[model samples]
Target: MPGDSRAATNAATVLRTVLEHGPVARGGIAGLCGLSPAAVSRQTTALLRGGLLRELPGPADGVGRPRIPLDLHTGAVGGPVAAGLHIGVPSSTFSLVDLRGRLLARRAFPHEGRPPAGLSGEIAVGLGRFLAEFDSGRPLLGVGAALGGWIRPDEGTVVHHPVLRWRHKPLGAELSAVLGLPVRVDNHARAVARAEILFGRPEARGSLVHLFIGNVVDAAFGIEGTVHQGPGSAAGDVAHLPVPGSAAPCACGRTGCLQATASDTALGAEAVRRGIVPDPSVPLLVDAAATGDPRADRLLRERARAVGRAAALLLDVFNPALMVVTELSSVLDEGYLEEIRTAATALSHVCDDPRRIVIPHAGPAVLPEAAATVLLSRVFRDPCRSDERARSHPSV
Candidate 1:
């Protein structure tokens, strides 16, 4: 490898080591990441200079300065922050997160009655206001925008989003132009996968599959800590994956598709059709179920089983170390997750251990943290490049 590339890789290694085991000494970082002490020192110096890492006071037992602990600069002041934007069909979420992907503040922006053509502009305006209200003079790294679609992250374009009616839209550039900050765009499925690998379970780094069941249903796969984005970055399109025992009709003239059978949209509509909820809203259905509505609980369980059937197919194919399900009811309630695990384990020939399937570690805060991971992931991969990109953009 080239000299610069090797240095960047070493820098990322050191950064991730500290992220996993922070407030640790330089020698500990070298020991954890298997790098030489000199290399660890070089990267830590650069990271501290870049304001990504900070040095805490050394032990008072007369230990040398080299033994001082270091951690991600997550202090109340001067610590850098990343902005997150999760654009769902019905609403958008804006979040401020620190280096560790912790949510500092968040706001929801509903898109009711907004035209598809002008939706991005409206979101930009609302997001700008959100940032202004939450800005505490911290170093704003940039924005990471995640949504359901065939996204080209490298080009920062939305190749296709059926729900949003977006095609070949330069979403990242538009948002950056309006917000005057660096913006990275990616599919929410992959974003969640990356977030899991970075901040969730340790087993996720070995291998994992993430299934997202929101207004849209999609999946993402990761191996060896890297999420896969196939040709044109459109790998996670599981909307039409067949779900066994489900005969729900899909708009594509197909029946038993995963999205049609298990997505929040389908579940909400089913709840409304059953007179369990007044409107097609997953949250309302969940609320009803929580309030002892048996009808709503049964509907959620039915969708959970359908999601499990689809997850069974994925497990049989990939057999990843972990299978993360990001669904509203399942994340909020363990009963629904148990239903999914039971159904998946029953159907999956390769996976009998229900423990392998779990909800995202962040739970209710999953989308916001995952959206921000779109940019935070880049920062961990190559902090130098991310810093340069942030420097190019106007400070928030």
Candidate 2:
């Protein structure tokens, strides 16, 4: 209920702890968090009264004791309390997710045009529409905008972006004001890395590089379960890594860049070069690949090689513990995918640990949902310092 600071902090921690690792014993939670059993009981009682957590129906293990394993009342915390947004150049997405990261209701729509505010405006509007459409009355603890470009968390601005055209914009502040919710903004790639750390693999907590492949190409670094957001926040802009022999041109006017060599759009452009304007659609490309179209096969394999080369380059420099490559889920063959693994394994120290290089299957959910992971992380990590700043400032 309407508690003060100390109570709030304790309550939040207890709730967060249970949400993170549930079906857990109350005494066990107290011991793990270094809180007294009484303190744990008080917080649990408060949370139970608030309907944020509940005890599952069951008896204790072993002989005749009882252990009503406590859990986040999934019907409540799992149904609401957090919402995620994935913003992009062409479209934006929104979702209501529980503590376990289950999607309750979600919406996707095309951006009308490139607004002066870039994603700031579209995300605000799209989220409003999504909430109204779904009639989701859940408290929106945060709004996370995941998008491309160079985002500097230290400065709280999108330093520069070719895709979003957002430069030095106070994206986090602007949207928080409009949506009336604390917000967390991060690079799409970093979000993918966070997703892997929190949901994908606990081992990825150590040093790792998240090489994300999709309609766009980029990479992010993770250490000790945290994405290495750079001095400003421009850590994963591998798309601009210069390619010595790129045949395709980049949107940034660069003659040779990784994105120019490997992005799906880059592959589709090859069809035009061959004098065939394939219709613009993801399903169309997938259909071609399933039907064994030689051109699609060649494009996919060549693109996989470019991705492999990028991984090798990063491994040479970062020497990360692992590399998780995110790509389209429909991709079932490793025709040249092995070339990437072979390159990472042979050129770097990844051979000893086969888990070093892995491909994470992704679909429309990869880029955007990854963006939301940063928001969820803030609550679990530290109540979101940036979101706290958003709450304090109220305006940029």
Candidate 3:
């Protein structure tokens, strides 16, 4: 078993190389992984046997001795998969991800105020049905549930999720007991940072901070390709951080907390207060801001400034190689991103001219993809193990 695990880890490394630079020659993989050509050949043979690698067509010009390249085979039998579920305040998403960073299937739905216990049961049934859709030869590694709140991963529990009204909920255990599979539960921001390490830009591997700006404001720090979770996984709690020039009252009896003034929910509420929108909803406020409403623009710009300030604080403390911001509307737009950057540069001592910043250029699936990455990472960690499981179980 240990030998198989090690082989799986090596196979995973090879698979990762192909995933990053697919249709790549065996010699290139050997050079990248620092393995001999023979070793690479053996690994490729095993991967092909396991149905994880497939050869792509060579040059169309019919050039000199065709050098075939390998790719991570998807939508095929024998590839490992994992289910990922992200539970938000208004909705939840279920996704399936292959170890090769391909999304197999995904669906989002509203919860209609189901309690945590009931929601766990619903997820169990849903996951069962989803898994049934795939070929049984496709190994299902496990499931990961991501949510917005404080999470105690070591204890396999959600310490608190204000939006879901969950406290001390055994989410991982509940799902595991019901689904009969391994389960991981974590904060959505933390999970997103992990996702970056697994599937984002190459630079995302080193020291970095992922700032998630949506209904709530939170951050996660990754160091040397791993999340730096502090005591009880509460390292990046920036929601309560105080912001200057904001007098908004916070639920914590404090004034000007980041969440009180900078979160999308807060901004939308402020938009309604300022008569920019009829109802307090982020989508509505975004629409108003897009339509050249001065009130909406001003409110969003102020919130963007607040976000920039918070990011500057993170940079000052962490001084990471880069910071990835994922805001719903403002940060995604170039003009608005610049506004936040300008405000942040003005506020922080060392964050001036902070050019080492980035945002996901990919569209709406960022959050769901991140959630799925949480589970897919396990397969990438050890492909041989997953392959073994796939072989152990036979589809009828």
Candidate 4:
């Protein structure tokens, strides 16, 4: 229903409250959301009717009647699901996620040369094959694509991806046309940050920074449980941040950029150049370091320092409550993380406890899960809004 701003805000608040503390009583929701029981009941009724929330049976205690709890209708195995797609430089991944961001299925495909003109169609076919394994009784909410480089989420276009040589690609629209589903697209690192905010342990809320350290070096900041997507969704473009004491050249034809020094590509190339590893790959370098190879250790320490410098710079600017670093195996070492902490503390004018920084070892499945969380978060953020679109399609 077309409603006033206050009503919309109330509904959104109730939905988020339920998502965060579901299987909870309406009275508890009212207290948590700062709304009266009557208001919460009204909003929850609307949500239940919209098929976004379900009521659980109340406990049969020997005392008075128990109040039924309200929760997001996401636990059902035969309920609706969302398709997540990630287009990276080396490979593409697809995953199925329920409304709560739980992974149902995941698959990856590696490609070489360049992305073809019919890449969207190819991905759509792959998703179709992946979906065939699941029960067809479940409805599909939409597809969320995570691409590297600049993205305009509002327009669902990838403005630029130098790694993939893609420019001004209407990826979301193309994929949507192929699959007959709604599509949303954004930068891969930012998408991962969104997932961290939505599904991470210790429940990362308030101010947070997520750093992705692999083939690319990018960061995303989450404030007040929402990612700080700046104008044009280009807020976390820290790849070009200048790094001191490094002579590496950046892809932008510049010297000493963060990506040139801290990225896995840079580390791998340096490992091969220094004869530490015959192959230029992160896994090989990490393996060599794990085996106590002095040369590999030296290279990794150098890269770790560079990443520390970048982290320091970010801390100075954002002063996030916590910083989550991904793909940095050396983070397990107190000495290694101390290097980052020391640099950040020294460089950042606003100092906080260094222990706030953490590294998440999510393995290869992180990207696919990140892509799916992009769609899942939207539902949690505004169930009423997304439910409208879901109602239109009913099933996909």
Overall lDDT per candidate, in order of appearance: 0.93, 0.67, 0.76, 0.75
Candidate 3: 10-residue stretch with minimal lDDT? 387-396
Predicted model with the maximum lDDT = 1
Candidate 1 positional error at 282, Å? 0.9
| Steric collisions counted per model | 0, 1, 1, 0
Q: What is the lDDT of residue 47 in candidate 1?
A: 96
Clashing pairs in 4: none
TM-score of 1: 0.97
* Model 3 score (lDDT): 0.76
List runs of model 1 lying over 4 Å from the truth.
Answer: 387-396
Model 3 regions lying over 4 Å from their true place = 1-9, 49-51, 57-68, 75-81, 98-104, 115-117, 126-141, 177-181, 387-396
- How close to the true structure is residue 22 of candidate 2, measured as C-alpha lDDT? 80
Each prediction's RMSD to truth? 2.4, 4.6, 4.4, 3.5
Model 4 C-alpha lDDT per residue in residues 1-396, reported as the tens digit of each score: 446446668888998787677878788899998988888888888888867777777767733222678887775644678888987656688898776677778888765553566566777787767767764667787788887788888778988776666788888778777777778888878888888777665446777887777776778888878888788777778888998677888878999998888887888888899998888887788778788988887777777777777777777788887777765555445556666666666666776677777664344567787887777777666666664455587662
Number of the top candidate by TM-score? 1
